[model samples]
Target: MENRPLIGITTYLERARWGVWEQSAALLPAAYPALVQAAGGLAVLLPPDDPGRAPSVAARLDGLVVAGGPDIAPDRYGAEPHPRTAATAPERDAWESALIRAAAAARLPLLGVCRGMQLLNVVRGGTLVQHLPEAVGHQGHCPTPGVFTRHPVRPVPGTALAALLPEAELAVPTYHHQAVDRLGSGLRVCARAADGTVEALEGDGPGFLLGVQWHPERDGDLRVVRALVAAAGG
Candidate 1:
C-alpha cells in the first residue's frame, strides 16, 4: 500500500432504518470503499458538509468519487420536477456540486456513478431526461427493485473507457430511472446503451473526470476505479 492514493467518496445524508434506529444518517454502500481499496487506494468517506470547505478538501485529496444516491432537484438545471423524481436533497446537492466544482478547479481525478453522474451533468449546465422510461420506452435501464439490470453499451473507440474495455459491447450493472439528456459543457460521450441512452461520459479537461450511469462498484468492475487511482498517482 506504499503508493496508495487517498480517494475521497461522497456519501448520502438520508433517513435509514436499522437495528433499533430510524433516522437521518450519512450513508454509502460498502462496495464503494471496497472497490477503491481493491484498486490500490486509501478510501475516505466524504459526507456532505459546509460548501465553503469543498475547495480545501479537494486540494488535499488525490481523487474523488461522487457516489450514487437520490435525485437532483430539477430546478437546479432549470426544469420542473417529474412526478417520478424522488424527494430532493437540496443540501446534499449544494455540497456535492461544490465538490465537483472544486475538483474541476484543482484538476483532480473524479468518478461519478448513477445520481452522481446526473448531478455532475446538471452542475455543468447540462440537463437530465428526469425519467428514462418516458423517453426510452423500456425500463430495462432499471428493471426491478434491489436488482441491477444488465445491458450492453458500446464505447466510442479511442475513449478512456474503450482503453479499459476494448470490446465493442460491455455488459454493465445499472439501476437508474433517469439519464443524461443534454451534453454538459466540455463533456464528451464515451458510451451509450443499445437504446441510445448515454451510458458514460468524460470531461474534456486535462485530468480524469468520468461519469457513468452504471454501478461499477456494486459488481466489482475495477477498470474505472483503477483508472482513477492511476490518474491520481500521476
Candidate 2:
C-alpha cells in the first residue's frame, strides 16, 4: 500500500453550526474521510463546484467517491417527486452527476454510496423508487433518521462484490428512502436485500465502478473501501 492513492469524496453543501459558524458550509461526516485514510488513501473533499470542472477534478484524482446526501430531484430521471421524496439538492445532483460522468470517462476507480448509488443508476438511464417503504411494504431499509440501521444484503454470486465480500450475507448500515428501480446500462446489480432492494452495483467498464446502497464508512469492514484504493493504486 505504498504510494497511497489520493481519493476525492463529494461533500454536502448545507447549512451547519460549529463554533459560531451558522452558515452554509461544505461538510461531510468525518467517517467518510476517516475510512478512506484508514484504507490507505489520502482523502480530499470535493465540494459543489461548477459542473464543468468535474473533468479536471477527475483527472487530478486517483479515485472518486460520491458520498451520501439528500434525495435527487425526480426530474433527473423523468419522474415526478413522491410526497416522501423530501427536499432535493439540485446543486449537488448536477455537480456529483458531472463528477460521476467524468470518473466514468476517465475510468477512474469510483465508489458511490446511498444517494450516490441512486445517482449512478439515474445517470446511466435508469430509474429509482422514490420511496422504498412504499415499494417494499416495510421501512427496515431506513427505519429512522440521523441514524444508520442494519439490514442483511446477499451478494450475487460470481460478482465482483461477492469476490470482495465473501460473506454469505452482509448486514449493512442502511439509511435511504430510495432504491434503484430499472437496471442501469453497462451496470449489473451485485447485491440485494431480503426484501429485494438493490444494494450494490458494478459496472462493466474499465477500472472499478461500484455503487452500494448501504454506508460502508459506518461499518468496521474495510474490504470495500480498500478495494477502491487498490484499484486506484494500480
Candidate 3:
C-alpha cells in the first residue's frame, strides 16, 4: 500500500576466515517483521554489502530500523578491545555506520534496537561500555539463553520514546550488555536502567531518531514501531 510507510531493516554480513562469504544472516528476531507489518508499515531488508548504494536504497523507504547483531569493534569509538569482546565484523561496522549517517542526513525516521542502539550511538560520536560485566559488575542484563526478562525503564517525559510508551514505569525485554557511555553530539538521553546505564536516546534536532537498548520487537511493543512509522509520514 503506497499509503503505508516503508521501513528498511538492516541485515548483517557474516564473513568467513578463508574466503568472502556473502550471505544474509538473521540478525533480527522474527517478531520485528511481524511487528512492522502490524504497525501498518512495509519492512524491507537492507544488507550490509555495498552501503554506498544506501542513498538509492533508502530513497524508496520511509523509515529505517537498525537491528541487533554481534558486538561492535571498540576501535570505532576510540577504545581497545576487551578480552571478553566477541568477534568484530569490520565490514558490518563500515557499512552500517555509513547507512546510519545517510539515514540521519535524509531525515528518515530511525529506530535502533539492542546492538542497533549501540551503532546509533557510535554513528553520532558516542562510545560504548565495551564490557558490561566488567564495567557494571553485574550480569543481570542477560540472565539465560533463549529467554527474556522484563526490566524497568524510566523514560524521560516529553521524549519520543516516552510518547510511544507513556507509563510511569515501562517493562521491556533485555538482551544487551554494553550500553552508551558518552552520548553522541546533539543526542539526548531519553531513558535509563536502574544501574544508571543509558537505555534510550533521541536526536536533539527536529527529526525522528530513537534508539532503545531493549528489543521492543521481541516484547511485541507495536506502539513503538507504530510511532516510528507515523513519524515517517507515509
Candidate 4:
C-alpha cells in the first residue's frame, strides 16, 4: 500500500435508525471521507469519546479534520445559550477540543469545517455570535436544514487559502447559524463574506492549520483538502 497520510475526521453521536437498528451511533457524512481519499489521504472516522486519548490519536495521525455538527454547549465558552441553538454534545465538544489541543501541540496540520471552525475559535478564547441571522440581518448562512445555501467568499491576499484558491472570489457551500465574533488568540481571519461575516481563519502554528465556515467536502472542492493532504505528505 502507498504511504498515504492518515487524516482523522471527527464524527457525530446521534440517535439514528438504520436497517432494524435504532440507536445512538457515531456517524459522519460520506462526503467527508470521500473528499479526504480523493485528496490522496487515508480517512479515519473519530467518534467523540475519552478525551484523555486525544494525544494518542493525534500522535498517530498526519492531519485532523474537525467535521461540522451541532451547536457547541455555550457553557464551554462561558456564554448563555441561544434559543435557536441545538442541544449540546458535551462529549463531542470535549473530545474535539482535546484533539485540537493535541494537534497543535504536535504541530499537525488541521482543518475545521463549520461547527469545527467555531469550536477551534472557542477553544482559543474566542466567542461566537450564536445567532447570525440577527447579527447579519438575514438567515442566509443557514437557509434550511439538509441543504446548503450559496454565497461568495474572498480570501485574504496573503493567506494559505488565497494561494489554494487564487481566484478573486469563490461561491461556497455554506450552512451555519453562528460565526466568529471575536478573533481567537494566535489566529487570524483569512476570508470573509460580503456581509463581513468571517469565512475562514488560520492559526499561527508550525504546519497548516486552517478553518473554513463553508463546506468544501459537500461542494467536492478539493483545493483545501488537497492542500491539507499535501502538507501532511505521503
Q: After superposition, how far is residue 47 of candidate 3 from its true place, in Å?
A: 1.4
Candidate 4 lDDT by residue in tens digits, 1-234? 579999999999989999999999999999999999999999999999799999999999999999999898888788899998884688999999999999999889999999999999999999998899999898888889888989999999988778889988989999998999998899999999999999999986557999999999988689899999998883
Span of 10 residues, lowest total lDDT, candidate 2: 81-90
TM-score against truth, every candidate: 0.96, 0.98, 0.90, 0.97
lDDT of 2 by residue, 31-60 (tens): 999999999999999999999999999999
Distance (Å) between predicted and true CA of 68, model 3? Answer: 0.5
Tens digit of lDDT per residue, candidate 3, span 1-234? 257788888876663243576554535556877888889888878777677877776677899898887899998889998887774667778877887888877888899988888999998889999778777788878767567777898998988778777886888889876889998898999998888888899888887889989988887668878888888874
Residue 197 CA displacement from its true place in model 4, Å: 0.3
Indicate whether candidate 1 or candidate 2 has the larger lDDT.
2
Count of residue pairs whose backbone atoms collide, per candidate: 0, 0, 0, 0
RMSD in Å for all candidates: 1.3, 1.2, 3.4, 1.1
**Superior by TM-score: candidate 1 or candidate 2:** 2
lDDT comparing candidate 3 with the true structure: 0.82
What lDDT is reached at residue 2 by model 2? 58
How does model 2 score by TM-score? Answer: 0.98
Question: lDDT of each prediction vs. the true structure?
Answer: 0.91, 0.93, 0.82, 0.92
Among residues 3 or more apart in sequence or in different chains, the pairs in candidate 2 whose N, CA or C atoms overlap within 3 Å are: none
Sorted by TM-score, highest first, which candidate order results? 2, 4, 1, 3
The reply for model 4, stretches above 4 Å from the true place, is: none
